[model samples]
Target: MDLNYSPYDFGIHNDPYPVYARLREEAPVFRNEPDDVWVLSRHADVQAALRDSATFSSVNGLRIEPAFWGPDAERFFSFVAMDPPRHTRVRGLVSRAFTHRRVQELEPRLRELARAYLDPLLDGEPFDLMTDFAGPFLADVISELVGVPEADRGEVRRLGAAIMYRDEESTDLPPEALQAIGALVGYYAELTRERARGRRDDLLSGLLDAAEGDDRLTLEEIVGVAILLVGAGIETSMLTLGNAWYAAWRHPDQRARAFDGRVADWIEETLRYDPPPQALARTTTAEVELHGTTLPAQSRVLLLIGSANRDPRVFPDPDRFDLDRDTGSSLAFGSGRHHCLGANLGRLETRIALEEIVKVVADYDIDTDGLRRIHSTNNRGFATLPTNVTARR
Candidate 1:
């Protein structure tokens, strides 16, 4: 099979499993000339690239281009684009706020919040699950946790969305979108400054006070983290929950089994089956040999996370959506030092979501025509998943 994989193609986004399988079998280290990025479709190849951060640096900010590789990009991206010592310092500061214990403690409050958002939709009325529930829930959770003022949370999400709406193929940049990112950065910077003046009971305040001595994150670093938290925390969580529902509704047999202790398996399977973050880019630091091909130094490589999770070499019957599938090796949240920091938060949110859903909704039907797939190079999931939610009782 002559593999032609373009992340921007809507057809591929809609159902990329078949194409992913073909790439895994025929061209594990496929070159997507159209996008000017090398793609790693197989699990072994993607895992290798992720593990060797020195060879494939994140300093170029995932996907490389003139717009994102500019000087200011370093200040804006902070840790995500950094290599070692800097990445360690920033990650350490941010990690304190998202500890396993902290996430566990958030459960009670999250359950209450989940109930507040979900109770109204149990009236058998049509609800756009993605827009109405999943999206808002994640936005609210992350904003509240990060200490964004209640009045400003909505605006933050709006601006953040605009900033994140990237089209890798487009040459012209959207001024308004850039402005939105600018505004968001300023918003977080102010929050960071306020925390510096006097500590508040929030993540921003915690970051300001998080250090024994001179070792600490600068104002720009804090702001970068705030943006990172929001960007990385929301979309994947929102989509995972929405896609889980999409899966449950589409496969009742699996849904029935999910009511028991197996819901965790269902969630794990969903991550492997149809993850939100479909791909991420890494820049080659030096020339590297992959399979029989040589990836030149300074070239861009797009790691097809969605494709890798479905590699038949790693997973049998790769196309089938099975709740019982063993997903121990799934590359959903990724691997290596650059692995997702918000992975725990995402899993917690997803579990609580499914638990709440099973409580209120025993049977639901999807309006397939009402579904809208989000067209993004790095993300995959429905933008709108309309369902007539029914109450259990």
Candidate 2:
């Protein structure tokens, strides 16, 4: 496609690694003039931009949007999108609650949840893992962490999925997404009051109580952060579980090798191979020169994350989805200040889910024709992945 990459282009968005590899060699610093955004495909370039946050600001937040995508139809901003001090402060406040220990403590809960979801399906039947297992499993975990009432978890999942799976081709949000966002905002807005009224040992309660002297988060900000947490919580695990399993089934040998110690390896490879987040955009603060090209001030550059993860320089035999591929510190969760905050949680969720899947599911085959690729700007994965599984017992 002549280095003029359009994320809206269905074929490229679904599998842009090849084009990214080509661009890494031929046009490492290419520009999509139509979209008015620069493209960075190589690992070094993407990493450099990520590290040099001073030069490339993130005032734009985590809204790494597509050209034709909608306005801030459902604006939900968290610490993830902020720059420096603002990002630092908010992230610090929430980090106290989302600590590594908290995630570690969730291990048993995650394991139990995995079994709870998968065990019922182990009744020798075909099921859409996205709908029946992965989706609900992640939804429940996120709900527990956020302290959402059990009765309301289903509503939260439905709303989160609405935001997760939107029409990418539109310049404005579809009616369904808008309605879902409205409901999410309303629910969280009410939940914020609920948490404020009484205290609990949950992230939502923690967020309600987090502070820096008198400069606490506003009600809107609290709701925004809550929505962001739920959506991010649901999206990553859901995508990783479904994609990792799908990729595993496609490769018999690697799938076989994935049963034990290599389960983490398999999940890591899946992150590098086909991360849910395909790309992210960073706006330049001033004119910067790279690769013999001058990008002017205020230019937005799309870090081809999917491409960077598969960049041949960093990962040998890049395109092949090999679980054994030794990739060094892949940018699957990004890097620097804006790195994914939930990296550990996502890995834990995927690992636990996969461990359970291989236990009861003897052998499963993907329903190729039933696969539905989600059409978000940067997020890539299945909307529906129908799989027919056989039980060991």
lDDT, candidate 2, 218-297, per-residue tens = 77777877777665778878898888988888888888888645889999999999888887777788999998999999
Best by TM-score: 2
Clashes of 2: 2
Error of 2 at 28 (Å): 0.9
Candidate 2: which stretches are off by over 4 Å? 64-74, 167-172, 213-215
Error of 1 at 183 (Å): 2.0
lDDT of 1 by residue, 257-348 (tens): 89755778889999998998788788888898978899999888888889888887889997788987889999898789988888888898
lDDT of each: 0.79, 0.79
What is the lDDT for 164 in model 1? 47
Give candidate 1 regions above 4 Å deviation. 64-77, 161-175
